[model samples]
Target: MNFPLHRSSAPLAHLTPALWRRANRHLLAKAIAEFSHELLLAPQAVSRGEGWALYRLETPQSEYRFPARRLALDHWLIDAARIERRVGDAPAEPDALAFIVECRDLLGLSQDVLPVYLDEISSTLYGAAFKLQRERLPAPALALADYQALESGMTEGHPVFVANNGRIGFSDRDYAAWAPECGKATPIIWLAATKRLAEFSHVDGLDHARLMREELGEGTVARFEAVLAAQGLDPADYWFLPVHPWQWHHRLAMAFAADLAEARLVFLGQSEDLYAPQQSVRTLYNLSRPDRRYVKTALSILNMGFMRGLSPYYMSGTPAINQWLHALIHNDATLCACGFDILREEAAIGYRQPYYEAALAGNGPHKKQLAALWRESPASRLGPGERLMTMAALLHIDADGLALLPSLIYASGLSTEAWLRRYLEAYLRPLLHCFYQYDLVFMPHGENLILILDRHMPARVLMKDIAEEIGLVDRANAPPGAMERIYTHVPDELRTLWLLTDVFDCFFRFLAAILHEQGHFPETLFWAEVAGCVQRYQADTPHLADKFARYDLFAPTFTRSCLNRLQLANNRQMVNLADPSQGLQFHGTLENPIARFRPGAA
Candidate 1:
């Protein structure tokens, strides 16, 4: 009963016991630290004698004992070497999958989500092992590496999410070929959708024909048309789009049989250009031509708490949202002062399957099976002597345990304080101005923002994922249907959380930990520098004094939004994207680290 299973047999050769142990230890460290940050676990410090403190965390089914140091904002820094695992006090293998099962009750995971969640956890562990097996690149080498290399070489997934690397729908073969960490170049499958069923939109002056010509050269476009013409299909009636090769093989062929049978969706062969997957697995950069726009596709894989599907309905408004925000940024003096810009989503096309659109619910993932958007490349926007890297690279620690940020800091030749100050001005100041003056905010997470580097220090900030992530709190000031897709009624009190919880707590908390633990700077000095940035911005924008007081950036405490808690409650769809603030899972408050340095505070 032999079967053709060779493709799956050797893909995971790196998952040895030793590498598995290292990956397990790292995953456990993240789970313990992030779960504690979410307040799901209360670790008690116990003296192990000789002036060392070992912390004990207990759930209903298991106990974990480890030595850890506490940092600011209730962060737990677990020493991976000293971690111990047990079931009811008996020693056991350190299995992160088991840990999640043991704490399932405490984490509020439902019975239905437990098994699928475990599958995700195991895949994440495999990803960690694959990363650990790679050749160790020194911090300086990684800091100076080319942009795509650094993007694929990032070791840490999301800093806080335990199941951050879960690409649930990917098989072993798909993981090898498509996962960003695999560092493989994939040639995308091209498909033609009937114009009657698909909606295509682009920014003014950048129409569909021009984009096609620019992306697919005239020769390739003519060849594609010939392929369609041989099937008695007119290319003029069909719109061509790029599809993730995996999705085309695994989903569209099987699920949309009617469309194919009726010749509504015609197949075109692969494009000549190869694409390198970016940090966001769904977006790919054209490796063959660096100046070409990035292609972001609709993938049904579940990752980081939601099915990574681009909604067909939402796609209609994407170009409008990008254009509106682009114009707003160009007109605003405050945003320009910080050298902030966005990589605009210039063109988008979404295929609305008439069958699935009628059968599925409005929010179902099936309705978004085939779609792609073209985003302006940051590479095309680079100025002289400027290069780009995802801000997430700052937290990357090689397998040898050296941090990347210090190398970048040293290469800049600026004192640590001066470099951090410059970084904050580029990265954080625009966030402050957008929130206070315009009542607008971006999901300014590390992956969503690119750090434009000059001589190894951050010189400008380029925000991406624009159409989906930008939110406006003041709907009254918004023009009719400008950003209607993201416009929702967020309460006045919760408006600033787009900055505090998303920016300060989620992103900067780990960054501060990395810098302080690596001896680059003290945590105190880090927060004080942030305080100085806030104070200076407030002083310069005295006209917005009332708005500052209303939002109160210097407030002593802010809501501690629990990210893992939301995922635990419902891993499939943690929060409805339409109205995100309504689904927040709040667990008390975190005293703002910069609160003490507020004006007039001793």
Candidate 2:
């Protein structure tokens, strides 16, 4: 069997000997170092055999011996190159040289020209990574047209006929949007068919049709098989499919048993894809069973949260949901990591156009809303304080954040205000340290002092546009302190705007909307409270007040006056359900209980 070779610069031909030697030395040193770091054992005791590296580690957990193979090295090399490409430029330091060298070695290029190669790879990878992650291979031995038909049938409400060139043509009547009479037609059928195809292509050593009958009901399985028979196909030819739960429940069960059974002949609904080759058919079957409790538990572990719009109780009642949720969740992290690797590896190949197109295509209307919001409010407009507030707002809207919030709130039982205070305090206290360490100077209106004080008293002020504020702090302004102090604490990468755009802006907004829809007012209130705190901090800072007065920037309407206005608005909206737009105006002097004695309010 021929292993596919990745493309590299032609000049690599001249350096193949040197490259191999370098790779050997590098691999040996890397293996030893990894063994030492992970096992805490001397590298000398480690031994390498065909496709395996044996080493011993001392740990209370267990005496660990990791098995490493040459094949695994190949995979790792590919994965590392991909990661390096994704990360783009290496830090401009001697320590970063090893990373550059490793990337070069993977591509069979010399270290002398590594920087040039690295630049090429980074630009290429950044463009295509997101799209490639979504591409799924067709079931093995299934014709392209068949795959297209299968996918069309899954997504659209009708069975698709495949035309030449792998395009799926659906009758106008079958178009989901065009046909209204087919009330809530099962779309999962198509999803199931596609999954069956995927399994057939990817899995091994299984009777696909039998598994389908067992998983889907016998009647449905027979109909699916009949459809395949009519198409002049034998079921056994497709026996490599791996069963994924999403497809099985939504579409396969609804399809004719003949079609289902015939389709199953080529697919294995549940089996190892890339990992755990030794896993038995029975083990895979057990994991894929609709009744398995392990599915939700697995999903929670893998995705760092539960399925969206699904509850633990819901999972308990629905075996299909449970099974699919488990399969997806269990594979989530590994799939994510693999996708990242692919993006990195492919960067050098100059195929970013397709990747970017895929991302734009995949993101739905919700993402479109986020993109609009991002464009409407660029980070350049806000100062650090306001930017951080925006970040908080964005975080509140994130899907993962929203999904996990109810559980967290239920577990903590902290009132909305207290939760808001604690969360803001946790984020801001560290952020303040970052501000000081970065030596970011304040602007006019005492913004810096206000921000500092707000962090000190998180409950008092509200923070909006936090994302924008954080963006305003210049990298060069970072305090002259240990680099570790600045970089170590945050959960995700803080050095770039990608995290800001993707996680903070997009995902967070999604979370916030989900929470709002779910009637999780406490989460929203918590965000509002944080925003309020920030605003108050800016208002009360003595330096800010003095600067405003000295510069004649102070309006007759003071910071306290603004707070009073907001307080009145809140009370009118909450207590009497009064509209702020109505004739009743806040004179900024009403002694409402909520507004009274509130710092920075008159």
Candidate 3:
């Protein structure tokens, strides 16, 4: 089988000024819409007609007007073409950087944060331009595409956050070689580490040698061991770890110089199997053999609010968390009935540098610099005639202005309403059960989930990014020990906001808007379908009626926990997952779209 890998001499061919202007216009539109939703920049209503409205936002340096339709959850669906930017009565081109600089005070960006935030916005625009040039697949063709295609084809990063693809540390060459949107096949770098300094953990049925033998083939493992044996070192005392090639050259080479000099960390070269990075950036999928488990490595790059590194101390108990959660999900009839399952993190290995370990306080970048985890691939979970697609693709609109969601819905050969019903059941039903029945909540945003499409209709969904992202609202029920770190205590009034903000606002707000614009699917119909999913789930399980009422999904309003606000406040460490509600910036509340769909609502 021929892999779709290529080399290009002209990586920056996409950076034409024409594309730059177009990218900035699109980005400015996004900034306006998202910032408006967060209430950082209030756009006064200028006029209203039909469903859309004209609004004007006055900043100190500029007055901007854009046509936007206010959708459910205060979503400002702005039209990029009609947006007008003026500087003291003279029309000016809309540039995202200039817009940010002009509205820095309005955005509550401090003197230091403003410059760094602008850098992020620039990197995001750079990625957007690259995508505009190369991501050529139309939504209709993408409707029948495979999993990796859908993953890379996704144009929007995190739907709610404007500075989503700000890979701050990556250079232009690194972007070409490593960015998921580049669709390049990269080989994972393997390193042999002494067991004394490194920790290897896995589920019951697996061990280090077996994992190595399976992952790097027996021949390569033997070759690696022979290198160790040649150096007068015992291969038995060491464990093999997979790492991102970029991290090896960038962070490990210099930071872990002591380990390299002491022969504690031996770089064992690249593997024969090539892996393509997923949207999350750090996690890579094996293109050489699709059935192989994914390799998630620590990357020091600051992206989307945090330095993307896996904490060795925190990751040690990942397999245990997965083992517990997998059993819990399987034991329940409802989760199984919905065909919901998770891609388990089967094994993990983390190296602790003594110097950094002693010097660094708390879970800083130095402490989290060298670690990796292997998660089960969704390929093995596919049944006959089923294919995998990232839930993010549902919100993707290609450069041609064609949307993939409508394409998939149409390709399913079901009416819009019927297709949405199947989708809600596959993706949303299990989430409801997890919250109401078990008091569990996951960061079930689009990228954290995979949808199994049986000919374009979502059959079931697989949730990943586990162990780190999932939390138990009932903190008392958390498994004692390091695993208990997943405990997140939300106030009783704010429990439902987890679902409302994570699933509804973060994901569905954009999804409903796309459907309305691309497919003419009414926003009311979408919310109604969502309401039906919850009603059916509750009706089936009357035992959880009290819990459902207490944490009502159909509540009139929920706190607007802003994603960009967290990033704006501090991109380095956005929100402490251990204490999630702390330092949260909630301006006000958003009216829940499903409130009107309640049985007894006015």
- Scored by lDDT, the top model is 3
Q: How displaced is residue 550 in candidate 2, in Å?
A: 40
Task: Give each model's whole-structure lDDT.
Answer: 0.85, 0.26, 0.89
lDDT of 3 at 492: 95
Clash pairs for candidate 1: none
Against the true structure, candidate 3 reaches a TM-score of 0.98
RMSD of each candidate?
A: 3.5, 27.5, 1.1
All candidates: TM-score: 0.96, 0.21, 0.98
lDDT assessment of candidate 1:
0.85
Candidate 1 deviant stretches above 4 angstroms:
1-9, 48-52, 88-90
Model 2: lDDT to the true structure: 0.26
User: Candidates 1 and 2: which is better by TM-score?
Assistant: 1
Candidate 1: tens digits of C-alpha lDDT, residues 1-602: 12111233478788899999999999988988898888897789886544246988887767788988777788787888788877765887778887888888877788988887888889889999988876546777998887887888897888878888999999888888888777777679899999999989989999878999999899989999999999988899988999988888889998988998998888898988888778899998988888899999988899888988887677778888888888989999988888999999999999989888878777688887888999998887778998998998988888888889888999899998999999999988988988888888888888888999998988989999988887878776675763555676788787778888888888888888888888558788988888899999998999999998888878889888999888787788989888888888999888889889888887
TM-score of 2: 0.21
Better of 1 and 3 by TM-score: 3
lDDT of 2 at 310: 18
